[model samples]
Target chain A: MASKFETPQVRKFPIIPKLENSATSHLSPFKSKEEFQSSLGYPGELVENWQEKAIDKMGDLLGKYRSLRVYLDSCIQCGACTDKCHYYQGTKDPNNMPVGRQNLMRSVYRRYFTLPGKYFPKLVGAKDLTKEVLDDWYSYYHQCSQCRRCAVFCPIGIDTAEISMAAREVMDSIGVGQKYCNEIIGKVHKIGNNLGLPEPALADTLEGLEEDVLDDTEIDVKFPLDVKDSEVLLVTPSADFFAEPHVDGLIGYAKVFHQAGISWTLSSHASEAANFGMFIGSYDNMKKLAMRIREAALELNVKRIVFGECGHAWRVAYSFLNTLAGPFDFLDPRYPVPQHICEITNGLIDQNVLNFDKSANDDMTLTYHDSCNVARASSMGGIMGGQFTIPRKIIQTVANNFYDMDDETIKEKTYCCGGGGGLLTDDLMELRVKGALPRMEALKHLIEEKGVTHMAAICAICKSQFSKVFQYYDLELDQIVSLHQLVSNALIMNKKEV
Target chain B: MSFVTILYAAMFYFAAAILFIGLAYRVYEYAKIPAPLKIPTPPAPMTQKGVAIRIFREVVFFESLFSATKWTWLFSWIFHLALLLAAFRHLKYFTDPVWFWVSFELVQVAGHYAAYLMLAGLLGLLARRVFVDRVRYISSPSDYLILVLIIAIAGSGLMMKWFPSDILAIKLFFVGLLTFNFSELPSDVVLLIHLSLVIALMIIFPYSKLLHAPGLFFSPTRNQVDNARSKRHVANWAKRMESTK
Candidate 1:
């Protein structure tokens, strides 16, 4: 859906002035269908006493996560995080400000849990949990991409992502789940991936990819599926099987594996890497989905697991996989139990195992968009700042011309793709476009100043987002390419076979 | 002791009890609650030593705030540093023989200037809330009220400092309270107002956002190491779930 507000043209990415309630408060995603909600073991519909249930969930959460409890109590409202949110920067909605969005629940929290809010609600800005308040929670929490950019700047380290996740979890407990997240989570539960592509369909897609690779390179290449006794299990996003430039990334992964001569297989059982449970902030769901990869690894007897290019998926796989589904003692200890493709690629490059004809990608001048989750949540190569380096190192090795966007927007302080944190659904398209404004502005400057023609991203969500949102900012759709797409182009296949 | 002395003594005891007990409970709750995952915002340090260094820089220098916005960093650091010095100066009243540092004239002079600096910093913060659009939008009455309360406390304390009070009597009053012996409080208007505001601040410190004093240490984002892959950190509840599995 086109943004209802006037979209700004690209020129130094226009800073939106505060318009005092500029963003309409009522813009919300469609509710989850009853079947979708129940599939994840949540209530099938809004419970009889949803308010009480929601409050009970909040209480349960407060007891569980120290981050939630302390963050609720710790905010001094010093306003360091006020302008940090991309949604707030784009929409100028006061409610979108990290603190303002947090206050939606904090106000209600104060009313019920704190003495001042109980005795002097008006003085403390506390309010009861009304239907309108719940509506506000749904609308605003969805607007957040859970990027954690605000947390980096917050003096007290209050993460708005934590608050937003907690809010979504509370909403789900009351049967008010978002259709995008909960539905995909259900797909992940039943089918192996988010697309709900059944086993036969997944096998067909992989076979088609192999045929395409052979046709292009004129050499023998394999995309093995569910092959037991493989050395590595490649758990990648299902989008890589269907969507471009994501599929191009998948081809790149295949080439890297081929060049390195590593025996790797994709499992039809755990065919997906993107975990939607993280988006909805459900630990049980997250853990349940993570268990699939472990199952797939054991069933296939694979020694190592490697995640392909998806932003938040890498975060879950890198940061939480061991905790959720671990003790992967069966896997090869020579490598990390789960390694990022970039890290593996970087390692191969370091060892001179792969070769790239840099001139092959000479047509495109490129810059990299550091996907928020990968930039801020996950690392590469067991080092600090490897997340920033590994992908860039891969790009520079394969691509001739490369320029970074603004230094501020490149590293740990990177902006979200506006479509992350499960806001990738078509229903939240308006919010996505607006949220993308900051990153797009940085990209615009790179295009103008450095003549950069393409922006390569590692995350599937980021690639899809930039492809869609670029048109709004007067940039062509093809300007967004997968980081591995660059690698695929420059990858020189075995001349002897050809 | 007169009726006023007894009432003042009771007020001090009440405020002290609330402040200590409330803070104790909040901090206890924070310590007891488990962080279920390792979510240190990257590019965070990977080692425990690195995390300690990071937190030390965050606390002592306000490094994150400095990088985010210099104006905020300046104002907040000024207020915090000055408040720390002023609080240190007040140690003279509680200690049997004032600590050597507090007894020094140099430190006393710094404490004197700190009150004025604290007031200026509070005003700058208050003005930002009034003018900065984004910050203004997020400002609630309590946000403004908290600043105003601290400002009043500093302002009243300055008045007593500028126009001298019955220092011996006030010191004796605090010492008496500390040692559990009742004593008559000084009969100075500015001193009384300052004491009342200080008491009010102490009572509200635990309930209000002042909990940030303790909460920052417990914040997982700031305090956690970036070694999630190397070490699997599952909370107690999560481990229990794993057991069932």
Candidate 2:
């Protein structure tokens, strides 16, 4: 026998499967290529022979190639990352392995982008871009959640998630994106948010929520809709108005505002906060999605804008909001001074504006889950929200057993909930579960070993992912609640609970 | 011993110290990313039982390479193992009695094989970098310098062993350099080249990405526990609700 492993290797990875979707399909499983092109602000059709697009534009394409090549060429394939992947850890498949995952993207990228392709293609294991390779690209790229957990272990400072994102961008450009992502983008274009709920319905929902709050607590909270000349325009993910954990989070927001007595309105036009453009990797879609919030805010003439506790929403708001929205007439140059709800709570806490009856949130050991997008991608730069101490301060008063996971479990290198991007849709459940294994495995230890009773989260999708994990592993879903709900549960407001 | 030897040795030693110190500091800094940003996993799954097998397959068997292109893996595996063994076997410098053990005999044999592997691997690696157009573009002057330094170290060390140079004097020079002193290398041109190259690699290891040796573990992605699901990732509003209610 030549070797024993080779036989198994053949049986392991089957030949590349044929592609299901094509370039000509309408309403592309991703948005139709034309719609996608429109979003990218590109004039021509989505790149057909994308390899040709690399011609004469070495600067841009080369920039991507350099990022990929640097990452791949530097990695030693040490398998230091075999068990490190959330997916790999969840399902010990070699294919789900991070190094192999990166190699899939990098090897292909190298074949097309690098100079060796022109001569020694086979030497580099590069081949023609057949339909099979395209299918492989889609399956493997989608398999990745772009959580960046794998990037943390990459030896040469490589980032596989960046590679996956870039691949998704390329796929979206080529009209090969997933249905959930594309359909959501279409919804954002048509109805101002991916959920496809219109302004009237959103207004109706908010009104109902206000009524419910008054009925339950006897508090007169104004669910502001299209209020012109308001000082602040507050926006949140649609999940806040509808979903379980996040709905309570919205209640807490209203409570904070009621206590602070700040003038704010929720624009019925642009209340949704989830941005699918980030998933598909289109700047145009990203801009268009963000622009909806801006136009709605401007139409209502709000002085400031505050984003709810969604991770990527605040990221877009903080990073690209100013550039995309533009020079507004009434904007304070600092047009939308984006503020996190925690910072808002922390402000109240710091100023002693709010009182707490901590016993109301009793019988649970609560710990904080730093949503990866918010902590690593955005904040890690400065203090409070610019890298704040506020979240920790807020967590202290919430529950008793505030045990940390481990030294490496807390910051900078936090793992994503695999459902990031548009993967939270029910269609990608298996992948999400598989990808969530690492985080769940860690949580399992905390619950069993570290006495972690309640898992506190800020993002809506994080709630979604955590709930699924809780159910899958038969852990407590009710044990998971947003920090806002916990705060609202125990908020020592001067008025009585109605 | 000439002044040039002493001066060159001093510069090499200083460069090596700077490289080691800089590399250690950089790795520590990378390791210190704040808590909220951490993506911690439960624990390493690649523990002693399973990892020993994996390490053997990767390091001892080079099994991955057997499937890898013949030229590529053959050359690479040979080079890496050789270098590894030689480095480990070289404990003879510090511990004189190291040569007497059974493991030492195996190491000596492994050492010879490693020397051969080193020269061949270096040639193959360098040739691939030079001739392969893609690798060529990524390759820089510093990359080539490190490769050349490695070759020089191997080549000169081989000369000392095979030609039987007065190793005591040469080892004394290295010891002196280690102890904040420098003397002329007590050997001829081949040995001189080896001594200088060893010192040069130590110096260059820090500034270049080659320092990825330790940098890998410090990577937050690999070492961290994926405890994202366990903690209450509450928003500011939630915190207020929890505290106030």
Best by DockQ: 1
Candidate 2 chain A TM-score vs. reference chain A: 0.84
Q: Best-fitting candidate, measured by TM-score? A: 1
lDDT for each residue of candidate 2 in B9-68, tens digit (9 for 90 to 100):
767658877787867765554444222222222122123344344334444554433432
Error of 2 at A152 (Å): 2.9
Residue-wise C-alpha lDDT for candidate 2, range A1-498, written one tens digit per residue = 111111011112222122222211111122345554455444334466755543323224334233432454345543334444555544444445666666655556546654544455554444555666656667666666666555544333356665666666766555466766776677767777767889888888888989998897778777787889877788888888888888888988888887887778887678677777766655557767777787887798877777888877766565445444533445554432556677677777878888888777777787777776676545421242333346666877655457666444455456667677566766556566656655665666778777778888878888877877567666777777888988888876656432
- The TM-score, computed over Cα atoms with residue i paired to residue i, of candidate 1 is 0.98
lDDT of 1: 0.88
